[model samples]
Target: MTSTQVPATPARVTAGPALTSAGLVTVLLGAALPLIDFFIVNIALPAIGSDLRTSSATLELVVAAYGIAYAVLLVVGGRLGDAFGRRKLFLIGLTAFTFTSLLCGIAPTALTLVLARAAQGAAAALMLPQVLSIIQAATTGERRSKALGLYGATAGLSMVLGQFLGGALVAADLWGTGWRPIFLVNVPVGIVGLVVARRLIPESRSRNPIGIDRPGTVFLAIALVSLLLPLAEGPVLDWPLWTIALLVVFPFAAAGFVHVERRMERRGGVPLLPPSVMRMPSVRQGLLVGVPFFIGFSAFMFVFAVTLQDGLHLGPFGSGLVTAPLSLAFFAMCLVSSRLVTRFGQRVVAAGLSVQLLGLLVLIGTVLLEWPNLGVLDFAPGMLLCGLGQGLAMTTVFRIVLSKVSPEIAGVGSGMLTTSQQAAMALGVATLGTLFASAGAGPLGMKGAFALVIGIQAVLTVGVITVARRLPDPRL
Candidate 1:
């Protein structure tokens, strides 16, 4: 409500120029890059470790730094896009992401790579929220619904493909670059996105914009780092005293963050994450639906990659090939998910979760029976079913979550959604990943650990199914 702030609702944003076919494709493509990069480093970890001579803790830092930085800055990025221009930030983010990727590609030390990865993540945070905000602002009615469906599908698929592509790229070694190619590949891709997006992607931003919430931003960063950092490093560092201290501090930090944001709103100022936005039934329920799924989804990918490499004795390309069924099935199901929602309503999500449960059971059976003999054929049936379910479940959930958010706050809402997702992924690595690591170290071995994690994921999915049933009617 400050005099300097733009009106809370602007006509230009509400009546945004129609996004062309090419424009939609360009933004969607841009959205996929950051997501893909998040997981693409998974399958390449072993090669990275060998080449960089880094310890397990250092490798985890490589992932954790990027994830933490990304999640922490996400809402702020969205706020900036709204205050400035979505198109301007998108180009800046892409350019910085490319440079950081290059820095990662040529890093001579593990420390340098981690630093560069953190910067790359910040750039991604800046770029991603605009994807949803633009779609929300530019498209309408059926067009908006379809675009959201496609965006959700793209988001979910990118995570899966990241690992597969990482494996393939590392295995290919493209002139003996080995694991470096995984990061280097983004350089060209980012450049292409820049060129296309500048021309095709329509510029859109919030009409009523507010200044940066510096206090809220700092507190949010503190809260996220406190929770995620310890979870990420505790097991690797043998649960040190400092990690314990950070864990003890998390609840307080999180509470303070909420208090600060609420205070800002009470003072008639927009906070980094508006309390009112969080108060929305759809936003809260949406997080409930998204958090567990992403946690399981992320942990599953990392553990699966480790199992394929260390337990099943698959090479990088072999592991990548093994996941081909999962990726293809997900992509296929996503293509039809919007239509399925029209026919089946939100029950598609419940049904999808049910399918996921069955798939997990199938996977348990396969693991118990096949053990070390597991291969593409052995894993394909369960992988296909799981992918199909996730494809439907994720796309529909995203639609429901953002369905109620008005264009006035589209940027913040989108940032919040993606932030929860990225944070959940990091938590997945911290929790289930740690559990798997421990189980493997114990007498049960890697195979037992993998089975245990999948069972846990099944239970998590079942819990999510109950929540999915409670999702407001998509027609709303």
Candidate 2:
């Protein structure tokens, strides 16, 4: 099958409510694991460090290694799913993720846990792309919008809940286990997800299949690793000379990857990211906006965790509870997103950013007002606004970015968008996280450091709004 010979519409399977509902649940379950894993370890990090006697730098690697591997492989994962069957890849990846989660739970040492986390990330790369691809191939228009909205909601809620759940599990020491429950809990959930997915998730593949772009895949992976690894681990490791050199080499490698991809396109070969899609103005702008949005969002979460724990002297559970308002607001706004998008179009995104900015400012004001007296309750007003803003903007952006994509290229397109998001998220933790850490170490302390972080995030939010303005209204 070739691009020109591809059908105008995606080839349909016999989809009914039962199958669709089950599929959605399956994908949502798959989506939840990676995100949950991302933050679940955060609250547990202190526990793990104390238990294993690991340094802050090594512990950072425990997080960074997984993120870097996951971000690097995600595109190839999507392409592989296109070549094979999505259901097949989904099942395999889920099984791998579950097993790796177990490995993470039982690992005897810090080094082993880090390796297991990296494996878990690799498994996530295989599973995550299939969620969007399945939705793309299976649904259209309003139904598609709603599904995407749920995905956004799930993504946000999982980040918040992961912290809470991790905290609770660690505190509970279920089975006399401490932080291990964070990973161990996934065992039962994975079993249920796998069984349901096998029964309900229909196998779907690109009707117009293209051979794997092996060269493109390799170069892209190298380019991503070169860029992401340094950013994520550089500051934590005291900005080593090797990290600087890798960062310097990243752009050239990325350019070469693009050049090779273009050549492949001209020669009628498959490229991991098709040049044609990259040429679309909407796609280009949407990606531009997505990068900053994700970067700021991820960085904020990281900084918040550190601030609550290290700055305010809160325990894991307290920190998690503080974020409850944000999670609740996100859920509430997500429920109304489809209608809001319909009524407001791209402006809804702009409004969301504005609201988010307001929320941040309010939060900043509260921090300034209370200073040393500030606690989780003091954060409620700003958090509610921030949550609402994030929900509105992020979900709207998800819808806009994929608006022009068709089902044939859905896997690659979704891959392109998500890869940008994951890369930005990793960089966010690396760059902004470094800034916060450095500032906190200075005479300024944690409050000043948090204020600086939130200020930068606000600036990024402004950038997102500016880029979003250039996007076509009503999506397509």
Candidate 3:
């Protein structure tokens, strides 16, 4: 083996032994910020475009640039965390994220805001992977399992809560900052997270930390940017030449990335992502499950936002109120999900998907029967069902996917898992978002478009449930 090709071993750190209870809370708090930020900004986009006097195209750039940067650098950040220390990387990332949020909040131009969002995304990339890695490195057995479940719950809760908070903040327009508070609010939260994390969170890193795999990194970056950029910007720009060219480059870059990683492994050297890691059935199956879950969840968030504001003529606050039931039930179910998984085992995932499918059917029915007249109260039943279904499915799947990841490469495992999630999310917004936009804009009308997309998602969920039922039970 080459100097850097040491076999995966135990997690080792110079700083401490077990992570404290307070430590887990601190890290989970750190984990929630980036995710919440991701969804929160959407509610404020209209105000952003108007205030900045930027066209629809450039405003979309504000979203795309951050997402692309965040998704691309995730694995790199995770690798660095394993090499350095999780706590150290988390602190640095949190600090940088806070600064960037300030930059975003105060930016004078659309271009600058876009740039700031990119920096913020890069900071998030640096911070997020370490949460899972920290739990992997410091906790064991049931503690680790509980932590992972909570992480999953945190993730599911964050998406809906971000949307809820974003609408409230923008509608309040606190001090007439007009959408700027959404970014600025991160400042205080980030500061608190930084302080608590440094004091309570334990430091950990891999015993055999791998060096940078430059070729793998470059190829992966090209592949994701080629795919994500085109998808993120294509609909906005109406499929320009450059976007098509990038799309054409995506598969080749992805192939090259795979080749580089495998070649490095064959040659007894380390690659950014070890082939062995992906070879695990738990990891593979979990990811397969995650892709569809993330796609559906993100697409729901995206389309619902558009539907509420544009189709129903609701203000941001009213939109949030409509989703309030879902958000609340999602939180409650997330807490209950852990217990259900323990009692029901592998069947819980299938059950969750079934519930989600029913919820979607209810949603379609509600839209068909009530829309144009559907108020916040009228939307409650379907929203509550969706919340319960998603909470159960999301938490259970998270446990399955990351259950077998070893501590030595926890960061890698976490990074790889999260990258897939972000890719699925980007794909969701691109594909389902496009479908909803086109349908809503056409004679389908907002109500019909809404039902159609939810019906499509319901079918997708049914397919996922079939796969979930067929899988072998997870060992964890």
Best by lDDT: 1
Q: lDDT per residue, candidate 1, 74-193, as tens digits?
A: 777777787788888889888988899999999999899989988988887788767777877789999998887677667557856775788789888899888898899899998998
Report model 2's TM-score to 2 decimal places: 0.88
Q: Which stretches in model 3 have alpha-carbon errors above 4 Å?
A: 1-25, 49-64, 109-111, 134-153, 156-161, 195-204, 404-410
Residue 439 shift from truth in candidate 2, angstroms: 1.8
For all candidates in order, the CA lDDT equals 0.78, 0.76, 0.76
Could you tell me which 10 consecutive residues in candidate 2 have the lowest summed lDDT? 1-10
Q: Cα RMSD (Å) per model?
A: 4.7, 4.7, 4.9
Worst 10 residues of 1 by lDDT: 1-10
307 Cα displacement, candidate 3 (Å): 1.1
Give the per-residue Cα lDDT of candidate 1 at 348. Answer: 88
Q: TM-scores for all candidates?
A: 0.90, 0.88, 0.87
- Clashing residue pairs in candidate 1, if any? 7-208
> Which is superior by TM-score, 2 or 3?
2
Give the alpha carbon lDDT tens digit for every residue of 16-54 in model 2. Answer: 232387689788888888787777787777678777887
Estimate, for each residue in 1-476, the C-alpha lDDT of model 3 and write its tens digit: 00000112225544457888999998887778877787677666667867898754465456666766776677777778878887898899899999999999999999899899989988987887677778877888898888877776686577677878989998998988988999999999889888888788888887677677789878977987788667756776789999999999999999999999999989987676678878888777776777888788777876787677767878777877887787777778877876787778778888888888888898889889877887888788888888888778776776676678776555556556666666677667667766776677789988888888888899899889888886556545
lDDT-better candidate, 1 vs 3: 1
